[model samples]
Target chain A: MRRLYELLEQDTRTAGLTRVAVSTVAVLVVWQLVSMVVTNRLLLVPPAEVAVALVKEVETGAMWTNAVATVTAVTTSFVVSVAIGIAVGLALASSQALSLTAGPVLGALNSVPIIALAPLFISWLGLGFASKFVLVIMVAVFPVVVTTEAGLRATDRQLVEAARSFNATRLQIFTTVTFPYALPFIVSGIRVAWARALVGIVVAEFFGSFAGFGFAILAASQTFDTARVLGYVIMLGAMGLIGSVLFAALERRLAPWRQE
Target chain B: MSTAVRLKIEAIDKVFKRRDKPSIEALRNIDMEVAEGEFVSIVGASGSGKSTLLRIIDGLITPSGGRVLVDGRPVDRPGPDRAVVFQQDSLLPWKTVIDNVAYGLTLARVPKADAHRTAQRFIDVAGLHGFEHHYPHQLSGGMRQRVNVARALAVNPKILLLDEPFAALDAQTREIMQAELLSIWQETRKTVLLITHQIDEAVFLSDRVIVFSARPGTVREEIRVDLPRPRDLHVKRSPEFSGLVDHIWTLIEAEVRAGLRQG
Candidate 1:
């Protein structure tokens, strides 16, 4: 029974995702189910009509445009956050005074919701990609910084002492011991950051955007097209999910020795 | 001084200030020396300051009083001139075996190709030829300690300091490494100062065994090994070797029993 449960769990994770995916499809299917019960199109568009509407939007290339814009902003912000965050984390972990100073300030910033700062960001940088990118950076950078810092500081002192005994220099110690030791933490931080950055891009687009998944959904909502809006939402979720998996694969490849 | 002194340490003292306690006397008025190219082991109970003596002589820690001179020159901060194989190998996890072995030469600013060639040479000497690409984590503890020895000898220091380098290894491996180290010493003729709590290890490895008294450690007795060169595992079984081991054990029994109580 336990063996069967393990197999069930495995198949469930892979196949069960389809059921969860049915949330957006269920939005389409609900009308058909209701039609049998009440025969209403004015109340809810059928699944076929919503598919046609989604295709109609895609045929105009608007779907691709929204995708490209949101992706560009999200990717840029995520990279910026990862590079700066890890650098700062490593630096702060290296110095006691710097860690003491930066720790509290970063913690305070993390506590303040970025959503509440949307108006301020727009007012300061305008509603262009600049504001959205910064918003995404703000959302993404924290986790990377916190996690990388923890990783650096968490290095085994015994290994470090051993390195010193070998007459290893400061640069050598960092490259050999500290960086590799901190890799898992760095990967975790970046994974969470990617998710946050993607969410930031969508939220930025929802409030104000020339084009994005958020704009597409808002347009669908305005016309009371629940199926199209749900479709866009599913696409956004899929994109973030795929991005995280890709990064996780990269991390695993880079630090395969760590698992043992 | 008939054997000719290889190094001299005089009036060595150390005081470490604990936060709440009055200054603790770690060592005091310690004076000792090793003969030229002699393999001498310092044996003492834990906290008997055996390790501190080696550190001071290695120039990792400066003596609070007095001075240590290697070949008559006062010892300074750690230099490639005096290589150390510590309890911890300190191998960089990211560095491959060759890189870790090559670290000292690189710091000395040796040319890259030459340094790699030199490190590769000693890596072979340490009997770690094919494992050159492996990282510290990739090797067993004994293998890692071999890398540590290789790293120290890579610099070809005039003297070598070992602080129980094999204490972490299993008994069987320790015996094998002891033989390897003995052969290495025969080849390099390095004046070695090793510290260990193991009586048999101290007896088996050294040309002279310097035993220390209980805490605020002072040199209790420096029994000459009087054994022949190329000492083997069977040497421990010989009556002559056991005689020296028993003599040193008698001198250190009080401290060793004291240590067992606290530990």
Candidate 2:
């Protein structure tokens, strides 16, 4: 036991891992105790039962089918929303007049809860992948727009003046200085928007999509299949965790100057 | 020394007006002509608008009245004819040392491979050899200024305008930078206009030192330093250099006192 404690305390990474594993096991024990006391299988299920149900869902191939659908929708929506957001952000940033006029309007639109727009998206784009796509775009674009504008506007004035002193053209200055300066901020904005994009796809799927993790949860819950419902919840949480890790890694790789 | 006039500032005046605030006259009738290959320094108290005059000469900002002529043409906008090294490093933080040095040439549409090759020579001259791939933030403040100087010189402009380039440095680094600048200027033979409040710096570097009065700044005196060529750290020990430094100090002292009395 002393040797194990010493090993755990040796390195920060090892210590962190040990702590997380311990907490996870502790939570599982608590959850098992609660499930045993409740005795209602529909409302609560043990961690072991949930693991079994998750394995059954996977073996039946239903998990992969639904996961693929959600992944496809997420990738498509994320790409489209980012593209549109960047184009609109550059447009707004390029001109003071346009930024002033459209900036408040975009902020107001973003202030409205995205879920409130789900009915409109369903009616306009139909209750399919189209609506999900629109909903994700709505959720993702606002953060991108706000962060992009702030980044572009906040570019160092002295840097721009230095470029201009060398007779650099407006386009050259934008490409060489403005864009690179804004890139780290843009990457951070995308990181924030990535989580929102997942939320959007899940919410949209929960309401009207033919298939997704959210749909699987809804279906499992309707039958009071608590084990399968918990499994789907765990899967969704895992997806979000994976996305956050990927973006954080990308941020570190791209913006190394910011790390120190 | 070349007799050709490289830059002519003709009766320039600058007044800054703000909403509901009193109009501030920043520069008034600032008339001077700088000859080709002449190393001139402008000395003044703080808020004397010395920087404003340099900006006007660089064509970064237009004077409210009159104009600056460069190479027999009116300078309405910044061009490749002149380059400025600001007090701050102003080196793009995103770029590596070599890329920052090559930036001006690239803007002039020099091919990338050629620009980088030419930039390497300046990188060596600026004493930044092994740090080409390092970004600005990775370098020290003095190192960044060296990169800044390299970037300005890489463009091969007719004159280098430096606004307190060494002011941010410590005394030791500033002296080292001054010596480096003189050596660089000796090699290139480019005309230079340096602005600073450091009397010894002005006396040590300049062929002629132009002093400006505080507020609505104009030339108070133009002192010629007749010190011998290729002088090193030993020159500052000589009485001639100290005498000139002291004389300029008195003139600036009177100017600052006058400014205080005006208030």
Best lDDT goes to which candidate?
2
Q: List model 2 lDDT by residue over B1-263, tens digit each.
A: 87999989999999989899998899999989889999999999877899999998888888999989887899888888899998996988778899999999999999999999999999999999999999988988899999999999999899899999999999999999999999999999999999998989999999999999887788899999999999787899999999999898888897777767777
Per-candidate fnat, comma-separated: 0.27, 0.73
Q: What would the per-residue lDDT of candidate 1 be over residues B1-263, giving only the tens digit for each residue? A: 24778789999998887898888687889888787888889998788788887778777677789898887888756666687788865676667899888877877778989889999988888889899999788899889998889888888888899989999899999999999988888888888989898889988888788888867888888888778767889999999988887887888787778888888
**Candidate 1 deviation (Cα RMSD):** 4.7
What is candidate 1's lDDT per residue for A184-253, written digit by digit as tens?
A: 7899889999888877888888776778888788888888777688668767878887878777777866
Off by over 4 Å in 2: A1-48, B254-263
Reference-based lDDT, residue A232, model 1:
80
Error of 1 at B4 (Å): 5.2
Instruction: Check candidate 2 and list the clashing pairs.
Output: none
Q: Taking the candidates in order, what DockQ does each have?
A: 0.33, 0.67
Candidate 2 local lDDT, A1-260, one digit each (tens) = 78767867764667767865877888899999999899999889999999999999999999998899899998899988888888888888988999899889899988888777787888788777999988999999988888787888889899999998999999998998898888777777888888898889888888887788888989988988999999998887777877776777677666677766
- Specify the highest-TM-score model's number: 2
